[model samples]
Target: MKKITDEQLNQYLEIRIKLGEENFKFINACYDEVLLLKKEEATKNIKFEITDFSKFRDFAKK
Candidate 1:
């Protein structure tokens, strides 16, 4: 399995369309999976700390 960029996927889709290929659904599914994985990978390193919920509660009451 080769890693492909979003641009590459779009280009390939264009070529497939031009050639009248029938695998558009499959390719779009792969593209969607790639985007999801990319989003997950990007957020994997994020860290959150909730040290003050009281402030949020006060704000919500207003």
Candidate 2:
């Protein structure tokens, strides 16, 4: 089994907390499915592609 990095774990935790329990589970399930594709590869790479909220702040005026 590959070792999940501490940074990835922390990011996951932050995402979970921000999303709350209900949404957290749903997001986690999606991630799990993606991870399944790289089973036991000894190097797990979890990258989060989140857009900055400030980028959309201008849209609020519309």
Candidate 3:
């Protein structure tokens, strides 16, 4: 992930500090929950590649 600019960092800190610790905690929790849900939603079509392993095992190596 790219680092935020100093200006953005200053803005974010100002907003969160103004919101206060208690409110900031709630915001953080909600943000995390939403991010997880959004990630799950985004991967709805994800595919897994299945492979049989017996042929690639140690016994087959020789």
Best by lDDT: 3
* lDDT (Cα, tens digit) per residue for candidate 1, span 1-62: 79999999999878788756567667778889999999999989976469667777899899
RMSD of 2: 16.7
Runs in model 3 deviating more than 4 A are 47-62
- Candidate 1: clashing pairs of residues: none
Q: What lDDT does the true structure give each of the candidates?
A: 0.83, 0.76, 0.88
In candidate 3, which residue pairs clash? none
Winner on lDDT between 2 and 3 is: 3
Give the per-residue lDDT of model 2 (tens digit) for 1-62: 79999999999888878899999788879889778856646345633345645555768767
Give the clashing residue pairs of candidate 2, or none.
Answer: none
Q: Work out candidate 1's RMSD over C-alphas.
A: 9.5
Whole-model alpha-carbon lDDT for candidate 1: 0.83
CA RMSD for every model?
A: 9.5, 16.7, 8.1
Model 2 TM-score? 0.45
Lowest lDDT sum, 10 consecutive residues, model 3, at 47-56
lDDT of 3: 0.88
